[model samples]
Target: MELSGKGGGSRERAALGLTFVLRHGRRTGLASAARLLQLFDVKIHHIETRPARMPQNPAEDLEFFVKCEVLDCKVSSLISSLKKVAEDVEGNREGKAPWFPTKIRDLDRCHHLVTKYNPDLDCEHPGYTDPEYRKRRAFIADLAFNFRHGDPLPRVEYTPQEIATWREVYEKLSSLYPTHACKQYLDAFHELEKYCGYQADSIPQLHEVSAFLSERTGFTLRPAAGLLSARDFLAGFAFRVFQSTQYIRHSSSPMHSPEPDCCHELLGHVPMLADKEFALFSQDIGLASLGASDLDIEKLSAVSMHLILLGRYRTNERTNKAYGAGLLSSYGELMYALSNKPEYKPFDPDVMVIQPYQDQNFQQIYFVAEHFEEAKSQFQKYAMKIKKPFPLHYDPFTCTVEVLDSPQKIKKITSHVKEELKSFEKLS
Candidate 1:
């Protein structure tokens, strides 16, 4: 028998098969995803189809790998040069473009697919004709339209007070690390609202936000009751909006922080919220994951990284399309993940649940879904298996840590600490 089992048909059906196999359990993640593509006759679409084989002895390649940095340096230099060109082009413009210029033409095509294929439940097929599918189509349309310009990011201009605050923070950070990355942070913050507007009034109510998010993103942390309580969770409050805080990674830092800082959480996850099906699926997973055990939460994290990061990694091999905001923000990560060198495991929910991952590196393994519903159905089918009594929990005593604060400095981080505790306490 073939690894993916015999297969061929429409892309949707093939994607659906992949979805079913991945959801079948954790052990088959790579195989299921691989087979799903094959079944759909898209196996060659993955970069990992013929992955780089690990030498019989890894030590043999150690020297070669070390010297490869020289190649990496050259590649980095080329990327930097291209980025400069992109920046120069963007600077001459007045506003952020609706989407990347290269991506603009596909806006209508994606919209058409969503409109024509918005899945519905009332139809003969449960996954293909559900109202939720229509919503997802709309969400995808928004994402395609929003990011079609060369610089799809919205221009966010901050108030004087905000700019001053950022300047102060930058000065303090710059003192410790004299790097140019901090300057980028300063510039980006000052331009907030210009690229990404903050709407205090437009903020969706917690319930409404939770519902919409749940449907699109598979974050089931809404309705605030039952095994999972929306009122008792943090995502219910923090991840409700489509606009993200303006910031960028410190190119100099070697460590990655997990807090959903405004930059990653907002810019990375919010724009896709505009796509209804995607948004709902994401929301469902987020909500469903609330109040889950640490083990389950980790699994959800694995799944998230697998799907979102993998989609991003495979976005431009001229195959494996991407629809997540996180992938959209970083051009380097986006293209590299999908490049000829990376590994492409099949989409298997079972393997995704148990796959070993190093938080430090961009994910080594990725799962691909045929469409939004295939992704959503996996969550719904495995609802209880992944369900939580509350969002992931940590022992306050151990999970919490102290931060340094100067006498004159205001407590910028404690407020969030209290919110976290309150959420836990309510659950308690």
Candidate 2:
């Protein structure tokens, strides 16, 4: 049987099959390869084409399955022949190019997760499609883009309207803090008020807040472009780095935001980060995110946000504070969550990690912790399940990630640091 003309023939083939996936541009070459298979008495079972999921390049790829009862040696020969055809196709397109069959690797999964969530590095929320919102977003993005990891955080000059928005939220939440917020949050809030400019009529700069957190818990803030993927955002916490937005929420909706704004980040999240136990708990969640699959990262992100927003609290009990920023920052939601409306469940890592997240509106259920220590203990136990091969540490001085891939690497890095410290001590 001679196969020719795109090899578009219908034939009944046997059960034994081998499948090969090739880029769409290789379709003509695939047909030619099919002809070679026919010459070798290998029957072509079927051919399938599907669109590639590449957002930037929305092209299609081809898959071909061939049926044959050939020996192992013959199958190897068949693979080599197809590879040659692919190389020839490439050579014709680009001079002296080499082609090889694609192989799946462990890192492919990680790369896919990043690409899936962050197709465009400059992704903006749909609401920001308006020209005015775009301008605000661009301004924030410029600052974030220029920022380097270890340098001092850039100071942002808030417009009068922005300061007004901050003033409104600060005044309301501050009044409620003494009565409704947890003790730890109130303490941190008072400290911030005194030291970091956490008061009415003035917007506190991120550098001041970052410095405050650094002194207290080694947590520092990095400017964020906008709402980041769960994986990317949580990964920062592992390094004691918080990706924060410099932009305030749209002035029109000061109380509500479809996405995170400066008010939500500064007021809702930063206070908890200032608490040592809560900071550790947050980092533990981030540590588990290392080498986690996309689905697991999504679960982790949801759980982290849930804990932050609708923190664990009991009804009519004012002794234990709600540590979640979502509760501490939002006057309405905080009061609503503490009320007798939402179902309150004990903090269970197993259930909470996989629980579906609802961001469109207030959550119907919340997981409550007895205290930050309890939350931290539970989170540590949950983190043990993560099977990342290498441990990661953030270097404050250099502002880089150190992957302790081997014991030797750890010793080398630490010994160098120890010697440097000794030299400084001698000089002093």
TM-score of each: 0.35, 0.65
| Candidate 1 CA-lDDT value | 0.36
Question: What overall lDDT, based on C-alpha atoms, would model 2 receive against the true structure?
Answer: 0.65
By TM-score, who's the top model here?
2
Q: For model 2, what is the alpha-carbon lDDT of residue 296?
A: 61
**Cα-based lDDT for every prediction:** 0.36, 0.65
Tell how far residue 243 is off in model 2, in angstroms: 0.9
Q: Write the residue-wise lDDT of candidate 2 on 220-331 in tens digits.
A: 8878766776766776776677888787766666776656778888898898899998887777776677666556666677777767666765434535467787777677
lDDT (Cα, tens digit) per residue for candidate 1, span 158-192: 34443443444333432322221122223332333
List runs of model 1 lying over 4 Å from the truth.
1-234, 237-248, 251-261, 312-318, 387-428
Q: Give the per-residue Cα lDDT of candidate 1 at 205.
A: 28
